[model samples]
Target: MRIMMLKGFLVAALLLGTSLSHAKPLVLSSLKPLTLIAQEIAGTAADVDTLLPESASHHDYPLKVSDYSRLQKADLFVWIGPELESFLQKPVANLPATKILTAYDLPGLFWPDEASVSDDHHHAKDPHLWLDARNAVTVARAITEKLIKLDAPNTDLYRKNLQVFASKMHELDNRLLAQMKPASGVGFAVYHEGFAHFVSHYGLRQLDYITFTPEQKPGAKHMQQLRERLSKDGSCLFLEPYNNLQATRDLAQELHLRIGTLDALGTQSTKTYSQLLEQMATDFLTCLTNVRH
Candidate 1:
């Protein structure tokens, strides 16, 4: 009787251990783009979700009451850091250092030309670093490393996912380069400066930006200057989906220029990170190449 009772307890303990070992880690990312990247690396090893909604802006997102609980419960929290989501600073301060992964610290990031001399209080650093494919590769690797540290049992799977992601990105880079060939010298203007990294990477021309940030409307003097510039050589004007459409439409109509839409947030179709990049490249090509010359 004693031997049988001990055997039953041992079996129960073994079963509990097995279940715990196979449990998936929870990863919380700050935005949709990062969530997509994390999902690529996590595969089936972890559950990943984004804190920000599709319609929200990363620059000034308000943290809801439930967000604090989500952040606290997350095994790993991934974000771009204070340069982009300053609202998260105080809330994430209590989280352990090991629990947070800041993508800004990742190598090969592209900063704006004026970021070096500009004060942080005055000029905001362009937080759209994911626009550059090279930066995305670095970020994906960093995420994989963090996931491995958090969930050792899934290290092999995470590493394998990273390899697949890198391979896919390489193919995307080549495809986008070939597709954007016609847009190389085509002059265009944007409502904001978020596309600098992407435009520079593809060797495309951005004649000028009407506003440095999306939240702020361009003053009359700035609008006039942009109008003058576009009147001379601009083939198209790209407006962000989140920004005020009326202003962009009015400006485009006034300048007699073709209008195109750019969604830097990856809100349109986000089934996968690869899909997001493909859609963005398609939008760029469709707008720039189809412009009325």
Candidate 2:
């Protein structure tokens, strides 16, 4: 009887300990690539949540009433800056600063603009910095730090995961550099000015962009200018998957140029973030070379 009781107690204790260690702290309100990187670092340890769904646009996102209540429950909340997801600013400010972090600090892309007419896209200095793999590494490291600090028990796992992720990003940078270096001085124009880091890292010229930013379409004069510029430069018109296509197609047809749609957001189901980086580098090489001069 004594042996059986001891065995039963041991089994019960083991189950209780397992359940306690695996219990997850709620992380709430993720946006865009920052969420993806956070999920990668957190793995299955915590319940990672996103207020905005994958398909939803981060810019001009409205907060749900339920989200306000949910924010009260979060152990940690991650978001891009005011440029991207400003809706969360007021609520997040109420929380301790340690619980809130901005992924935009992870090295943003630079856009050169002498153009006039400040539109929605040019409003916040390009918040799509997380699309770049190099920037993604910075994001991942920041997230890992938070996760480790919040849950020290998983420190080893987070560090290991971050190291692996960083290594992959470094390898991707090298691979892209090799592929893009040969095509030096190549010029191309995106529908928006989101790819500053991408173009700069690849040494491509992006003198004119059609859309002021991803969320807003260009005006008539801007379209005409872009069309004329495309015809003269022999560079391809790169459209983003999430962008409004009517203006882009109109300009492409008018200029008799082919359109290349790059997946800036890296679709939720199709390509993993790392694979998308490789695909983008390949697309740039292919598109720049194939365009008719």
Candidate 3:
């Protein structure tokens, strides 16, 4: 009877240990684009989620009481660093270095031109690094490295997922280049300079940007530059998700431009990063072709 009871206790302990070992680690990202990248790496081995709502601006996102609890509980938190999500800096500063991964610290990330980077370190560091395909692969690898440290048991799974993500991004890079070729001649205007990486990457023609960042109003000088350019041709005016609707519509009307929405945040329901990139290219082509001179 003693031996049987001891055996039962050992069996129960073993099953509990197994359950603990199989529990998925939660990977929380600051933005949806980063979440998509992380989900690609985490695969089914981990649960990936985003902190910011799809409609919220990264510039000034308010943290709730529950958000702090989530941050405390998350096994790993990923963010693009102070340049983009400045609000998260203080909340995550006290977290153990191991629990947080900043995409800006990741290798091989592309940055904007020196002018675009601006003197204000807090405001401009080309936070839209994910707009480049190459940076996405780098981010995936860094995420995989962090996950391996957190959950070594899933090393092979994370590595395999990273490989798949890299291959898919490579294919996407080529595909976007080809797809954007026809729209190369379509002169366009963006609300801000955030899309520079993507535009330059795929060789898209952007006549000008109204501002350096979304929150700022378009400077008179920049507006003059755009007026000189867009006045000659009817082209697409690509606006970001955060741009004011009435103001943008009025501007588009003033410039005789066709409006197209570019969800740079990837806020729309896209199951995969590939879909996100494809959607961006499609939106560009659709708007550009429709607004030809």
Q: Let me know the TM-score candidate 2 reaches against the reference structure.
A: 0.79
Q: Give TM per candidate.
A: 0.87, 0.79, 0.86
Q: For model 3, state the Cα shift of residue 11 in Å.
A: 12
Worst 10 residues of 1 by lDDT: 113-122
lDDT of each: 0.82, 0.70, 0.81
Global CA lDDT computed for model 1 = 0.82
lDDT of 3 by residue, 47-120 (tens): 99899888887777899999998899899999989977788999999899989999888767876555432222
For residues 1-293, write the lDDT of model 2, one tens digit per residue: 99999999999999999997667766764664566677777878767777776666666667788887777777788887776667767877888888877876655433423232224334545666765677788877887888888888989998988898889878888878777775565556777766666766666666577766566767887877666667787466787767758867876777766567776556665335676666677666677777422
Give me the runs in candidate 3 sitting further than 4 Å from their true place. 1-22, 112-124, 219-221, 291-293
What's the true lDDT of residue 6 in model 1? 100
lDDT of 1 by residue, 1-115 (tens): 9999999999999999999866788999998888889899998879999898888888788889999999998999999998878888898888999999899887777655553
lDDT of 2: 0.70
